[model samples]
Target chain A: MSQQLDLLFYSLSDQTRRDILRRLTLKELTVSQIAKPYKISLAAVSKHLKVLEKAKLIGRRRDGKNHIIHAEPKTLIKIDSWIEFYKQYWNESFDQLNTYLTTVGDTKNET
Target chain B: MSQQLDLLFYSLSDQTRRDILRRLTLKELTVSQIAKPYKISLAAVSKHLKVLEKAKLIGRRRDGKNHIIHAEPKTLIKIDSWIEFYKQYWNESFDQLNTYLTTVGDTKNET
Candidate 1:
């Protein structure tokens, strides 16, 4: 599971791959079409797509001659769940700290 | 910014590092104390701590003879924001797809 997440985050760490995901979110497009906006070669774009695909962040389908790519939002959902768990953990810690401070204040006032 | 994020995610991409983060969420501990739970050498644990510190996921303080370490939740907040942005984008794409499909269904029925 950690390895999978590592791949997911590593794939997302690149600007080109993130941009590719953003573009795919708008609409499904061919590798050539996705590569058109960037200065990088189609091969480079394909490489980025492979990384995203390996991370399961994107899906590809062969459309006769062109390869169509679409963003797989489910993987992002998994990432969100992981973040949500830690976010809750962090918030709870803050709440505990707040409660501790309040108790200390009350004790001081009582004295 | 991208480079910083790259470092952040790369640092998080390890199981040992993630476990260390989970431990720090509870309370601050010295380097030796943190190393006590894992089977790895103290030096290995220190290396993981350094990675987490470099990613701004944790902070360290020198106290007398002990180096106290604490989780830095703020960096995770940044990561949450990035994930939130993409989540919204993904949701919007889903809505658009839903709308498009409904329109196509209605058009088919009309013909």
Candidate 2:
């Protein structure tokens, strides 16, 4: 799978990770701080961070032994653009089909 | 996994289906015509169509004996909106972090 698409979906698929992202929405936090809300082990949280990292949805820097996790919103712009570009294809077709069904039912007059 | 997210990613994760979507980009196609480009089976292609249908990315209707598959673009707008909403969470945090790094880095700054 393409990394862009992989990261796009992979980042959003996990419930715990989505929760973490939601938390990060409020503020940036250290790894342990982000881990505080979950009953899962810190190691599991660490693993989640790894997934986010590979997706480029989060960035990490060490503050002594602690890692500050920051959300990268721009990382999603590509994915947005991708989905946006392809959207016209499906959208327009459905609209035409709707028109066809509404005003031209088996008229066979399309050029 | 949530069905919305499941359908979102599950639909796009496959190469054959993406190709099918791309072809649908040019025009709507029947199951057999859609299957022509791939080395895979017509049944496999039908399975792919089912996935797209489950995602609500495509729809089907019978014209006599042919199943006319039409692209449903509106289905993607929800996904686009979902991504757009979360994007703010990431974007703001990242911008704030950038600001913190730039002008307030460990300088005994008061919040």
Candidate 3:
């Protein structure tokens, strides 16, 4: 699980790869179409795709001679689970802070 | 924004760092207490703390002779936002798949 997360987070750490994933969310696109907006070479775009594919964040299928890429958003659910743990902790901390502030306010009013 | 995400994701890519974040979420502890569980040297744990600190995922405060470390989960809100986009996309794709399946089911009934 940790190894999978390492790959997923590492893949998401790059701008080009994140952009590629976002584009794929819109619709599947051919490799050449995916590369068209970038100033970098097709090889560079292919490399980014490879990283995303390795992380299972995106998948590719062949259509005739072209490679079509699409986002695999289910893989991102792992990250959502991880972040949810921290969100729960964060909310707990906020509740504690609120309680403390209320106690302080009550003391001030009594004084 | 990309650079910050890069740092945040890169910091989370390692198991040790993720573990450290989880531990800190339980409660703030001194630097030495944070290092006690791992077999690695205090220096190695310190290095992991530095990476987490750089990503703003955790913070430290000096108290007398001790440096207390705590999880700064608010920084994770950025990740929540990023993941939220993918979740929405995933839901939309599932809806489209459901609609397609319904159409196919109706056609089968007609036959």
Candidate 4:
């Protein structure tokens, strides 16, 4: 796939993954429970979890026979900050700050 | 390529694309002007532009013989709102909004 905001967003783009995130948002749940709502195989949900984990959008905790997933908000916040930077396209001060931020350390490596 | 945030962010993950975006942030430039800094051929820059256009990160304006690229901030804001949603992973009231947003959305069809 692409990489930057792409990976982070695409991880979320999938309907199954989104549902899983929604279910997790409601409350952390076991893998099977998270998978229960979908018609796909449990392994499919497992793959989605792996993707979410790689994206760091969610973290998994082993609880008894099931793995419980919790949302990790930091990376998500980074994406917000990046997206929020676009406001600079319209706001002057935001523009200056964006110039500073984009040109900041290793931004070319952003994502 | 993955369609969700993945496609969006991944398009951005490349150093060359980031530089192109940085240049655009400074001012809109023709495709050739945008291609000058990169050691790669114009064809490569053109390819990147295609990716950015598909991602909707930038829009093109054909002026004379050049294509002037401009940033499209709306989609970025959508990403922001999405990332912002995870903030609800902590804030309870935000949780209500999250449910309202995600479940209300074609959650499974997210991207």
Off by over 4 Å in 1: A89-111, B89-111
User: Model 3 chain A, poorest ten-residue lDDT window?
Assistant: A102-111
Q: Which residue pairs collide, candidate 3?
A: none
Q: Candidate 4, residues A1-111: lDDT per residue as tens digits? A: 235455566576676676677678768888888888789998888999999888887898787887888766656665666555567664666667777887785356666
Evaluated at residue A16, the lDDT of candidate 2 is 78
lDDT of 2 by residue, A1-111 (tens): 375676667677666776787677567899999999889999999999998888887888888988999877677786687777677664665679888787766556776
- Model 2, B1-111: lDDT tens digits are 366766766587666776787677667888888998789999989998998898888888999879988777677776677677777664665688888887766556566
Clash pairs, candidate 2, are A90-B73
**How does chain B of model 3 score on TM-score?**
0.85
Indicate the worst ten consecutive residues by lDDT in candidate 2 chain A: A1-10
Tens-digit lDDT track for model 1 on B15-85? Answer: 78888888888788999999998999999998999889999999988999999999986688777777776
What fraction of the native interface does candidate 4 get right in terms of contacts?
0.39
DockQ of each candidate relative to the true complex? 0.43, 0.32, 0.68, 0.22
**After TM-score superposition, what is the CA distance of residue A62 in candidate 4 from its true location, in Å?**
1.2
| Best candidate, lDDT | 3
Give the Cα lDDT of each candidate. 0.84, 0.77, 0.89, 0.73
- Estimate the lDDT of model 1: 0.84
Per-residue alpha-carbon lDDT of model 3 for A1-111, expressed as tens digits? 689999999999888888989989988999999999999999999999999999999998888999889999989999998898888776776789888989788465576
User: Which parts of model 4 have CA positions greater than 4 angstroms off?
Assistant: A1-10, A90-111, B1-10, B13-15, B90-111
Number of colliding residue pairs in model 4: 24
The better-scoring model by DockQ among 1 and 4 is: 1
